[model samples]
Target: MKVFICERKMEVNYNIAEVYINKILFSHFWFHLLSLGLRMILSCLSSFRTLVNKSNPIASRNQSC
Candidate 1:
């Protein structure tokens, strides 16, 4: 009976470890996804800003005229 109880304890410990590892993996996945999303957003914003600057001719207009 004691051996059976010990085996059960080990199983429970294994399950707990599995859950902890899964949580770490899940968070890592989310962190990677968030970083990728942020990078995409920054790139898009920079491109849009470049487009706006190119279309805005006020900067090149002569003030002396």
Candidate 2:
């Protein structure tokens, strides 16, 4: 009876550990994905700004030239 009780306690501990590890892994995955998305957004915005700046002078100078 004692051995059975001990085994049960160990099983419960193992399950709890597994759940905690999975939660940590899931959080890390989401964090990496969020970081990647932010980088992509920033890259796109920078490109758009460059394009706007490049065209602004051309459009303005055409009237005088």
Candidate 3:
């Protein structure tokens, strides 16, 4: 009787722990995805800015004039 009760309790605890761990993993996955997305966007913007600067020498000269 005692062993059966103990086994059931352990199973319940295991289930609760699994839920908590899954929630943590889910949040971490989202955080990683968002950081990667932001990095991609910032890199794209920087590349665009450099391309515009390279192609707009007249704009730079006008500013200097």
TM-score ranking of the models? 2, 3, 1
Cα RMSD, model 1: 2.7
User: How do the residues 26-48 of candidate 3 rate in per-residue lDDT, one tens digit apiece?
Assistant: 99999999999999999999999
Q: In every candidate, how many clashes are there?
A: 0, 0, 0
Best by lDDT: 2
Better of 1 and 2 by lDDT: 2
* Candidate 2 positional error at 30, Å: 1.4
Candidates 1 and 3 compared by TM-score, better number: 3
- Rank candidates, lDDT, best first: 2, 3, 1
Badly placed stretches (over 4 Å) of model 1 are 57-65
Each candidate: RMSD: 2.7, 1.5, 2.3
Local distance difference test, per candidate?
Answer: 0.93, 0.98, 0.97
Best-fitting candidate, scored by TM-score? 2
Winner of 1 and 3 under lDDT? 3
On residues 1-65, what C-alpha lDDT tens digit does candidate 2 reach at each position?
99999999999999999999999999999999999999999999999999999999998999779
Better of 2 and 3 by lDDT: 2
